[model samples]
Structures are given as C-alpha cells and as structure tokens.
Target: MERLEKSIVITLCNLEKIFPPSFFTIMIHLVVHLASEAKVAGPVHYRWMYPIERYLLTLKKYVRTRSHPEGSIAEKYLADKSMTFCSRFLHNVETKSNRTERYFDGYYGASTHTSLTKLEHGQVHRYIIFNLDIIEIFRNLHIEDLKQRYVYDMINHFHIIDISFSYLFNIYV
Candidate 1:
C-alpha cells in the first residue's frame, strides 16, 4: 500500500501539467487512504474475499440443476453431511473400492513340499508383503496362534501366492 501510494503520487506529479487539476479529485483521495489501510488491515490480500471465493467454489461443485442452483447445492450439501454422520456406526465402511477382490481382508500365504535335488534340509523363505495394512495387522496380532496359522498356510499353499488372514484372528480373538 505504501508502494501503491508512492506510485499514485508520482503519477499525479508527472501528469500535473497535461491533465486538469479536477481529474485527480475523488479517486486520487481514495488512493491516499490505501496507506492507512495497510497500517490497520496488515495486507491487501488478507483483507480481500479469497476465503469466500473458495467456499463459493466448493458450493458451486454441489450445483446440479442450472435453473435453481441454490436449491441444488443446499440439498446436495445436506445429503452429504447426513450420510457422513450416519456412516460413523457402520461396519466394513469402505468409502472407496478400486480393487475387484479385497484379498487383504483374510490370511494369505504360499508354500510347496517339492525339494531341489541336493538339499538336505528344506529351504526357508520370507514372503514379500505388498499391502501395508496387512503388514500392520500382522504386527499387531503377532501371537502364537496367528503365527502358526501363517506357517501352516504358507507350507500348504506354496504354489499359490494369495493368503487370507481373516478367520484366524476371529477364532482366537
């Protein structure tokens, strides 16, 4: 605003000879108040309507019908809020499901009994876990029963890669 005031004063002084004195009466006086506004309000952008503009943009997305935009946005907003409030108590409340199979819901592993030619003992291996959520649950329930089930499933289903840990926890817990 100080910069703005400086620019305005410089413009007025430079154009004093060319234009009539009456040309800089009302608007130029308004420009002079910008310096005082900076002292009171801190900055021009903060005092502006950016927050209201952003809120209006959010409301605009809820507008479906062109004929009655206000009604459309109001109804849609209320419906979404009500659904959000209601979904709190629901079980298996998946908001987004990009996968066809939710394999992470149960215990899963792979194993085989076929031995290589010269090995005296079975070769032990660790599975590469892809799902972090499954890994977290595995860490949380790292007790004897679930760990045993994991080993059993891995030995039984070595040829197949997928494993489900669902029922193992349900039975023990």
Candidate 2:
C-alpha cells in the first residue's frame, strides 16, 4: 500500500513536469488507470484512490478558468469535438458500468449548456479539420508499440514546447 501510493505520487510528479499547465491531465490519466484496475479490484479500492477525487475538484476549478471563450476558434473546435466524443464515450462506458459518469465528471467537469451559433460553429469545424489532419499522420503509422510510444512522444513534445515558451516569455517580459 505504501509502495502503491509512492508510485502514484512519482507518476503524478513526472506527469506534472511533462504537462505543466494542467494537473488535471494527470488526474484523468490516474482515473483511467484506476478504472481499468477497479474492474477486478472492486469499489473498496477507491478509498485508497480518494486523492483522485480531491484532484477532480481542483480540475473543476481549473477547467472553469481554462475554457475557450465563446467565438474563439480553438474554443469552438474543442467544445464541439469534446461534446461529441464525450457523448459517444459516455454512452459506450455507461452500457458496461455505472462508474462511467463518475469518470466523465472527473475528466470533463461540467458540460457546455448550449450549442454555438453558425459562424462560431463554422470556425470550430475548421479547427477540428486541422486537428484531424495532424491526428491522421499518427493514425497512418504502422508501429507495433505506437500506443506507449505516442504518450512518451507527446510528453517530450510538450516539455520542449513548455521550456521554449518559458524562455521566450521571460526574454520578452
């Protein structure tokens, strides 16, 4: 039990370093891992995972501030796609277990209440297309270890970007 807690802390710290702006990402990853493990271990294991629940509250605060404002291209795009993905994922998961809502709430926070207007919607769709193009490059790869490799690659890429941006921001400001 001590070792498991230590491992979780270590993983969270490493994830924090890689994804500096969002502790929530680490929490979501933990929940995904826990959810998979809990299938066999059962609900009693969640007591040990209570830290994740605390993090979900923190995530809610973070997301409220981080939301892409109405009319922004990035906001529009992320909103639409996230809604669609959430809907489908929620449906699929709910069919298998009631725990799905708890996990979704932990990850996405509150759902958007309304749909975007046509002009805003158009901008979002364009952003989605651009994102899909980038994703497609990864989809085409035939590597056997792509899932694990992709996570490491993404972490490395984000680390570089974070360092580069911090250096540049400090120089200008």
Candidate 3:
C-alpha cells in the first residue's frame, strides 16, 4: 500500500503541472491505486472495494454518453478517426471469418454488425485518446517532471480508458 501511495503521489505531482490541482486528477489516481490493489488482494477486497469500483464505473458510463463541449477540433478529429479505424477493423473481422474457416469451422459466429453500427465508436475512441492526450499534454507542459509521473499516470490513464471503453461497448453491443 505504501508503494501504491508513493506512485499515486508521484503521478499526482506530475499531473499537477498541466492539469492544475483538481479533485478530478486526485480521484483518477485514487481509483487507479484501488484498482491495482484490488487485483492483488482476494475476493474479500473486491467486495469491500465495490463502492469505489461502482463509482468509477458510473463516472465512466456518464463520460461515455456526455458530449465534450470543451474538446478541441484536433481532439475530435483523432477520436473520430480512431473509432472509424476500430469499426472498420471489426467489420473486416466479422466479414472475413469464413475466409479462414478451416480453423474455425465448428465455431459459431454471432452477428453483431447491426448493434455495433449504433455505437458512437468515434466518441468512445475520442474519450480514450483524450485521456492519453492529457498525459502527453502534461509531459510536454513539464518535461522536467517526466520521471515523477509518466509511467504510473500513463498506466492508470490507459487502464481507466480501457475499462470505460469496455463498459460502453458492452452496453452498446
């Protein structure tokens, strides 16, 4: 737990350079620390940690549906492009299944294209890149503080984005 706290402190300090000290950054760090600790601890910890996980999960779901009124044009563009790339990739995978059927002959493929199309893949992708961009922006804003925050922030941010994306996708499809 000491190691986790140290890492979170280092991450918070690093993020502080670009993000301006805010509860948002602190919550993000705390959520990440708890997530990591939960993984190492047993099911009892998971049961105890349910409230935190549930809160984070709720935040993620809200973020997924909410519009980004403050996002820059470039950020929007990258997100759209990433979503397009992912959608196209999913489409290709679904359509090309039979092209390599020898290996998956008996396996059944469920059709999900219709549901997938309804998903705001662009927004989902954008949310992810936006989180990553936060770290990059922080790094660029304070190169001198690189070591103090980069690794843990990047890891936590990525994990959060991934969890959020998965949650949204599960709901969408």
Candidate 4:
C-alpha cells in the first residue's frame, strides 16, 4: 500500500506532457483507497459481492423467458425454497435429488438380502458376468459346481463386465 501510494505520488509529481489531466480522474483516485478496503470489509472473497455474484448466477439459470427474467428468477427462487422447507414436514414426498443409498447411519430401507435381490446382474454383451457376492451366495445355497465353473469361465474369457438384469436365476449374478 505504501509502495502504491509512493508510486502514485511520484507519477502525479512527474506528470509528463504526453499524459493528459483527464487521466487523473475519480477512478484513479479510487485506486488509492483499495489498500484500506480490506481494513473496513474483512477480505475481498468474504465481501458481500461474492455471495451476491453466486446468487446472481443461480438466479440467471432460472430465466426461461427473455422477457421479465428478474421476476421469473424471483418466483422460481421462492417456489424452490418453499418446496424444500415444506418437504421436511411432509411424508412420502418425492424430492428429485441425485442421491444413491440415502442416509448412511439410518435403517430406513428393507433387509440386506431383500435389497441384494433388487440389484442388477453383471453382464458383458451376450455373456453374463456373475458378481462375487452372488457367487458366494450361490455357493452357500448349494449351487452346482459345474454351473459355478461355467460362470468363472465366462468371467476369465471376457474381461468386460456390466451391471445388468438377468431372468434365468432371478438374481443379480
């Protein structure tokens, strides 16, 4: 700040014939106060403009129509906030959030065995890739050794695998 002030004063004192008096405008004067700005307002990032700019960008996304965009943004913002607040009190409300396995600590869903049955079977093109867990389950349930060997052969032969639904065993293999 002292360096900037020194430079500014030096430049003003040594104002050359090439530089016009109009160059010493209010904008130039404003640059001198920038050093003291952080003393008044914490930091540049934590200032009011940061959150305002973020909200402005969010509000800009709500504009579907070109006409009266501010009104549309305001309406959408209020509606979304109200719906989110209301969803907390409501039961069986479908909040379209992109989440898988909601709430880590709670026991909200069905049993582990029942949930496992709902998972898609791993596959590769026409060949199905059996899941390791399902194979373990099959071994416990006394699945044939020959069928297990066939599943292993399919896995070893084709490296590619995908999670898909299979109807043969009605299990996610």
Best by lDDT: 1
Question: With candidate 4 superimposed using the best TM-score fit, by how many Å does residue 116's alpha carbon deviate from the native?
Answer: 42
Which candidate do you rate higher for lDDT, 1 or 4? 1
After superposition, which runs of candidate 4 have C-alpha atoms over 4 Å from their true positions?
A: 1-36, 40-48, 93-173
Ranking 3 against 4 by TM-score, winner? 4
Clashing pairs in 3: none
lDDT of 4 at 124: 36
Ordered list by TM-score, greatest first: 1, 4, 3, 2
lDDT of each: 0.63, 0.54, 0.55, 0.58
Ten-residue region with minimum lDDT total, candidate 3: 138-147
Worst 10 residues of 1 by lDDT: 121-130
The reply for model 1, stretches above 4 Å from the true place, is 1-35, 43-46, 96-173
For each candidate, C-alpha RMSD in Å? 19.3, 25.4, 27.2, 18.6
lDDT (10s digit) by residue, model 2, range 55-154 = 6665444443345533354455577667666666675454433344554546456676897999798567545533566544433342223344566565
- TM of each candidate vs. truth: 0.33, 0.17, 0.21, 0.33
Candidate 3 C-alpha lDDT tens digits along 127-161: 66456654455333333343354565654564544
Given candidate 1, what's the lDDT at residue 31? Answer: 65
> Model 4 over residues 55-79: C-alpha lDDT tens digits?
8899899987779887888899999
1 against 3, candidate with superior lDDT:
1
Candidate order by lDDT, decreasing, is: 1, 4, 3, 2
